[model samples]
Target: MYNIQGYFEVESVNEATALLAAAPHLLVIAGGTDVLIKMHHGQIEKAELLSIRKIKSLQGVVKLEDGTILIGSLTTFTQIANDPVIKENIPVLAEAALTMGGPQIRNVATIGGNICNGATSADSASTLFALDARLKLQSNQGERVVPIQEFYLGPGKVDLKPGELLTQIIISPENYRGYGGHYIKFSMRKAMDIATLGVAVICKVKQGNILEDVRIGLGVAGPTPLRCPEAEAFARGKTISPETIAEIGKLAVKATQARTSWRASKEYREHLVEELTQRALKAAIVKAGGEAIA
Candidate 1:
């Protein structure tokens, strides 16, 4: 730890941004789920605090004047998971929220907190990647909307400036159509455990045989949440049969090998991603009014 400090809970994004620009290395706090853990464990550099929890504008669900649904950054995971609008409009996101932490964690931890942390295994991000989520960054300078896939620069990093705050998540109306999705996370236990591996697969089913617009993204399988376009292309338009699903699994492993460099060799991770992806796809297919392809 670098040093100690008190909290400054600013009520507005502009206020938070000004505070951030002034502080040399302030660790922004929201919900305090992750920060408090690091503060207790001495894992994070010590610094002054800029808390965004009190910013009310950052805590609501809004369907904009346009058709896009705007999810406020400070909206808790529980809010997302339980919101009927979210469940009806973007159920995959709601499903992802359910897997975040325990109920208490879901109550306090915010979506902004998850994205800002930028961990590869961040459950929210992996799901969002498949949804083609867009993030809004607000600052004293201005605001910018960045596609979620491009928002992350590296692990524990994002494309944010010193005075920037991720203020909103935008999901387009086209993405609101019902689809099958599964977010499977591998951890030691079911609750309150970080994922060792996680997979999210979302796709539309057509004519009971063809797979259309398939998306496969992984958590803890890359430096940032990654979509396997190659795997997706190979899987799309294919029959949802077991042999075909297995082939898609293999392609997913091939996609991972193109990027991952592992000391343990890519075999195990590839296997996990493939297995998890297949399981996830099976679950999703069931939800999409189809039986598992056996």
Candidate 2:
């Protein structure tokens, strides 16, 4: 492992910002699940390390005045998965977090780290994109919010400023209503393997018939987590049926091809998008009907 000369445990956003500004080359570690692993693997050079783990205010759950749910940046996957409120209200997030890793990793991984890392195989971001979530960012300049969908410019790239820190994850509870959803992944093995592809499809049925809103997001199918807008458009306002779902899945393939950068090739991911979209959509329908979705 490389030598980290020093450690700074920052308790506030301003403190973290000042440190980051002073040491641009320093590594920021939240949960240490990714950064520490990289360091252990010698993929990273050790410099100053800023641990935001001591930032107390950044670790709880909050419900906004508008009925939105705001999970602090450091909130763990285990917290998200087990929270009754999350399960009762936005179960899709819970479902996504459940697939994140085993119990130990879940205990230490933070939602903010997952989103900001911009990994194509990141499990949490797949459903986060589908949910139209927003990110709250902070720095010495103060704080600002950005939609999660727009936060990423490319793989391993994000829009955060030099001194910025990811502070919160904001999700509107309203959009989650009547939604049937699921996150499905293809990996060599279940637990720790990087997903070959991860897919999330969340749908809200209006009047229990027409699709009111539909979101489809895929991971490892692209350079970044992104929604299949065409697939969503194709599904919206339509009645769900095997035939209609097939059409929407085709739109997923088309949308993914035009928008996403294929790490392997467009052909493989495009086809997986089609198949997974179909599977996820059907699974979501089953979830909505009070039946188990495989």
Candidate 3:
């Protein structure tokens, strides 16, 4: 039912990169959840498919000597949700992974493919953004590490260069250590739906009630998943309270460039941004051992 020019399965990063470098037209496929759908709709035709499912090295979670976590690109959402390391440390990513489609989709949907697809509505994007994750990209030429924020170029586009493949997601210890985080996905339905808006908040609390530092990531807010530096700046060193939380929400809205779409209007999305920002921050604050603000 689909037009395919060629199909190849690769078993290693080197093999995949070689193939990519030689055949620049080849489309990399991992879980094939998004790519196949596009193929079915004729959005993609006569495509040469390169499957990376057999690549063993690209499929697990590892903690490095430096205490940074390296998540292989092929890791499934189900794996992420159940991984002990993810739950004990960067649980916001696990929570985001769980909110993705149903169990079936989660079983095969990969973290790497999700990121490479460059969808702003991707449940994992905001969490990774809040975590300040980095991407390791490999090519036949060499490898390069890019900040996650720099990976996205626009809706449905990423900065992946020709012959380059995303290999690992890196999370430094400082990003997750002593931080409590929460992710909120606002959508039309609770299951099997893309986010109309997603907000992720992670913060460090000190002296029981003061916010030592904070990071906020918003999805479907603009051309890409965005971090609210202004809101984060406002929260740092502040005591958690209703007033502080309210102002943080307002500043979060200032970072968005929401636009009218079939899913929601710009004004409506902006409203959700402000409301959800406060809610997620409150939840994160509590998780960080701070008193709940009313």
Candidate 1, 1-294: lDDT as tens digits = 435566677898888888877873777889989887887788865557778899999997887666689999999999999887788777778888888989999999999999988888787988888888899998778899999989888878888877788999998876656577888887778788887677888888888767876788888777788888888898878877999788888777765632344322355676788899888888887776666675
- In model 1, the worst 10-residue window by lDDT is 257-266
| Residue pairs clashing, model 3 | none
Candidate 1 ranges with C-alpha deviation above 4 Å: 1-3, 257-266
Off by over 4 Å in 3: none
Tens-place lDDT digits, model 2, residues 16-51: 888887876667899999888878888777567899
Candidate 3 residue lDDT tens string, 1-31: 6898899998999999999999988999999
* TM-score, every prediction: 0.92, 0.91, 0.99
Please list the C-alpha lDDT of all candidates, in the order they appear: 0.82, 0.81, 0.95
**Candidate 2 vs. true structure, TM-score:** 0.91
Candidates arranged by lDDT, highest first: 3, 1, 2
Candidate 1: give the clashing pairs: 2-46
In terms of lDDT, the poorest run of 10 residues in model 2 is 256-265
Model 2: how far is 262 from its true place, Å? 13
